[model samples]
Structures are given as structure tokens and as C-alpha cells.
Target: MTASWKNINKPSSPTTAVTAAQVANGPVIPPQQRLLTYSPDEWEGFVEEWAYYCLPAKYKYVQRFSGAGDMGIDIAGFADDKRLKGVWDNYQCKHYDHALRPGDVWVEFGKVIWYSYSGEYAAPRHYYFVAPRGAGTSLSRLLANAAKLREELIANWDKHVKDEITGTQAVPLDATLRAYVDAFDFSIFDAKTALQLVDDHRATPVHTARFGGGLPARPASEKPPQEVAATESRYVTQLLGAYGEHTGSIVTHPSALSVPKLKDHFRRQREAFYEAESLRVFARDSVPPGTFESLLDDIHGGVIDTHDANHADGYEKVCAVTKAARDMQITANALITCTNPKDRDGICHQLANEDRLRWTRS
Candidate 1:
């Protein structure tokens, strides 16, 4: 009846694992790597969302299953509607001030083995150990050599895993259980390092929400060569509402487009709108078919890097998207309008300009 993982508040930014190059060249380090910065609960939430956003489209649902009776499973990804008792993949999120050592996780493995043996649920096709800082050197080496990992698990069973799996009863690794353990698939046990998590999350919408990786450069926007459509009235209305609230005066309609102050607001609104749209467009154009959320993620972060390392430096990444990459201009433009030229304007402005995010009419 035991469960796994802690739960915490929802996150609000991007996540990146420090690359070997970044370590040598000194790019800004992501916060999740800073010792003890994120609580276990926060890591759990991060993984929960990460799984939800990064799992393949084929996985119809990725849900949190970390509390009591979870049977040592944390995030569960389901391909069918049957939910808990169906075909699924599990992600175990672990947060440690230090990298994961072998002793820290063997018990969790034993539980998985025991639970499956007891018919609590079918063994997952994949069982990932998600650690914020990643596995320790010793563990990493062992994992790289799967045969060694298997040997080590069996070698350490009596000391690190047996008692817990047995609990109050005398359920030792009897021949039946031992055979299962001997034949158990260790390939299912994999580690998701902080860097891998960051890489995987880079394409998800909530990446920025949790890790805060800034988006690419803002793309330059010109007045689209056509007259503003009447459909754009919503943008005009919201800008006027902001102006009214900011300056304590009322100005309505595109007719006000001629007024100097309001006109500036109009231009800015249009620019922001186009930019936001461009980002969403960029997201759609980029990435694989199943990643609508990742597109949102890129737009939200105000930057999207080409998966192929087309741009290496931070400056180049932003500029390339803004000036070089075809059709990704809007992604660049919105990032500039919302996060760069000014700091801390939420997606509301981005959406308002895009016409989908409406503001108070009154």
C-alpha cells in the first residue's frame, strides 16, 4: 500500500542541464542544478509535467500516481483508457542534494519487482528513475554497463533491498521470486539525468513555466502590407482599455489610430500580436507532429533553438530565428515584445494581440 514521490506547487519556467560545452565555455547555468534549490515536491511536479509534455503522442495520458497505494510508481503514462491497470510507463522522480547513489534507489527497484510479483499491476514497459541532478559517477558507470547494473542489483539485494520488500512477513526472495528477479529485465531501469530532462523538456510548452530558459531574439516586424482588418477590433479594444486604465481617459475604436499616444499603443499592440502569432506559427512549423504544447513552450519561453544546433551562441540563436530562419520570425518577434524589450509581460499581452486572449471589455 505504499506510494512513491512527493508533490508540490506547479512550476513557472524552463529547465536545462548544463552541457559539457556550457561547463567549459560557461553559459548561464539552469537553477535545477544548483544544489538544494528545488524541493523533492517541486522535482516531482517537474517530472509530472515533463512526462505529460514529453511523452509521445501515442501515450494518450500521462498522470501523477505518486501517493499512497501507488505501489512505488510515480508518474504513469497510459496508452489506453483503462488507466491504472493498463499498459503504462512509469517515471520515478527523485531529488537529492547530490547525484543519485546506488544505495538510494535499490529499494524502489525491489518494490517494483515485488509489486509485479504480487500482481499489483503489470510491470511497466519502461521504468525511469528521474533525478534532478542525475546519477552519481558510480551509478552512471554501472548503468552504462547494464550487465554490471544487473549483477550489482543482485549482489546488493540482501543488504539494501530485501527487508523492505519483505516487510512484516517472511517473504524472502524464494526460488519463485528469485527466478523472477534473476530473469527480471534490468533494461527497463533507466535514469533520466537533469540534462536529459532539460533536453526533453526544451520542446514542451511548460518548459519555460518550470525552467525559465529565455526565448530567442525578437524578430523585427513591419506593418503587414494590408489594412488592419475589422476582425482586429478586439486588439484595438483591449489596447484602448489598457490606455484608459493607465492614463485615466477613454478612447475607443480604430478611429483613434490617428492620436499620437494611442497610435503608438496601436502599433505596439499590432506588433505584439503579430509577434505572438509568429511564435505559435514557429512552434507549429518546428518540432514533430505531436508537440503542440512544445510550440507553446517555445513561444512562452520567448526563444526556440533549432534542434540541430544551427546556432551555437546565445546571440546567434536569437538572431538566427529572428533574421535567418524562415517562418520563425513571429517566434522571435513575440519574445522581444513580451520578454526582451520589456521584462515580465505575461502571455496575456501576447494573446491579446493575437486576438485569442481577450481582456476585460468594461
Candidate 2:
């Protein structure tokens, strides 16, 4: 039977007049501006990312609650293990088409008051209404004046908040519930601007992955310490083996590199190895997990064949494989653009450190 699926030639379609709508090119939206366009779920994800960067310093634990039954909490950062029972802060994420106003949040305030009064959780130490477009002028004014905000909440309770908190039942502002509202602290309510959220999110590791911006400037790699630390034991031993095999002598340690050329080569290799290690550290703090590992895997894949090829000695094998790695075209990994020539060579040593690559057959 003919393999029609594998046919080489296909007829091209006749061309027709195309308008701008057909091509549909629009101006690129920067990530900061793009935050306002995220879907409800995506906005919550952004809030989660922001909380990770901004809350860890002050909160012992941070948790997110979603769906219609989350009471008033969207994201909560607990100051202690007691969680809701203990001191905590609330982040009410509002993903609205326009800036949040007082009307948008009266129900939220009522829910917090009702739920906390009923002992579902203690009233949050601080309640922040985080929205992409931020709070409108009237809401900002209300937030600034705590007594007025409380008064507005009470005034709007019957119209906006009486029946809105839960799906099952309408929470009436009875005498007891009214008393709770009267005594509740309204000054805790506030808003976080989009600029503040984005600025804080910039410090997180996933920022570059979420946004297409290039990485922040890398710090200089620390020089390798004078004595070989235990972390370098495996790779350093492998290097000595390669040197011993090349010179046909028992090269026990790095200090045994008596020849000037070999000494310089060893120094450069150590420096490169340090550079690669520094790159690894930088990846841990700058990108998502496994990014540096993927770069290492790419280097290994590019140079493994050269490493297995026959050479005069182990040192020659190291040189060949490292050179291959340096010239490799690694485009897929996120860390590729952030790496240097020395990092490529150092990756080979890192692979050796893991016994993924070896300089000598033995």
C-alpha cells in the first residue's frame, strides 16, 4: 500500500486579497502592562508568585484559598503555625475589568467580619485588597479614613453585603453581628498597587520565565579557594587521573603540576570549573528549577560523542570534549544565553564530578 501520509509534494492554495484583520498584528504588550489582562485564575497565580517573594520574610506560612467557598481569604500569610487561629494577613485578589472601588469590596469586608465573628478564623492583622488596576479614588479615600470606611460598610451592609457572603444562607446584620461590626478594626483594610506587586515579583526566580525580560546582571564568580574543598574531591581526583595518564607518572594532587604548560592548563580548568559552579548558583536564584541542569544536560549531549572518541591520553580527551562543549550551539535551555565559554568547560567537569563523564577509561 502507498504511504499517503508520507507524500512529499502538496498543492499550494491560491492566494487571495488579505486585509489587516487576516494578519492581525498588534503592538507588543510589556509584561508589566500585561498583568491587567490575565484571566481570573492567572491573576491568582500572579498573586501567589508575589506572595512567595514578598511574604516569606514576615510570614511563617503562606496559603492560598480559591473557589466560591473560600470565605473572604484569597491568600493568607500566617505569622505562626496556628494559621487562621493565630496572627495572619489576608490578600484579597480582585481581578476586575476596571479599578476596584468601594462597591467592589463591601461584600469582601462583610465576609471578613461575619466569618471572623463566627470563629472561622481570627480577623486578619492586615487585610490588603490587591487588584491589577488598584483602588479607585473613592475607595482610596475610604481606606485612608478608617472610621469612614467602617461607616460606609455599615451603611452599605443591607444593600451590598447582607445576602452576598455565602451561597447557602443570608447573613443578617443582627444586633450581635452589628455589635461585632461596630467594634471591628477597619484600619487594617488597604490596597496594593500593580506597580508594588510587579516590583516585588521582579526579585523572584520565576520572574524571567513568566516575563520575557533578560536576566539581571550576574555577580562575579568567587575564585576557587586555595585548598580543594570536599565538594571538589571527585572531579579533582578525576583531573589528577587524567594528568597522571598523560604524563605517565603518579600525579596525586593538583600541586604535582610541575610543568609550566600543565600548571597553566590546570589553573584555567579550575577557574572554568568555578565559573560553571557560579553559574549554577546564579541559576538557583534567577530562574525556575532545573534550568541549570538542563544547560548541563545540553552540554553533555553536545560533547558526549567527542568524550567517547579515541584520543592519545585522558588529558587529550578532556581537551577535545571541553572544546566541543565550548563550540556547541545550545539554544533551547533558558540558561544558555547567560553562560560563558568557561562555563561550558566547567560543565564538563561538573559532569565528571557526577561520574557522568570520565577522563580516563579506568
lDDT, candidate 2, 110-152, per-residue tens: 9999999999999999999999999999999999999999998
> Best lDDT goes to which candidate?
2
Number of backbone collisions per candidate, in order?
Answer: 23, 0
Highest TM-score model number: 2
Any residue pairs clashing in model 2, and if so which?
Answer: none
Residue 278 deviation, candidate 1, in Å?
Answer: 2.8
lDDT of 1: 0.62
Q: Write the per-residue lDDT of candidate 1 for residues 106-163, one digit (tens) a residue.
A: 8888889888888888888888888877888988787677678878878888888888
TM-score, cand. 2 vs. native = 0.90
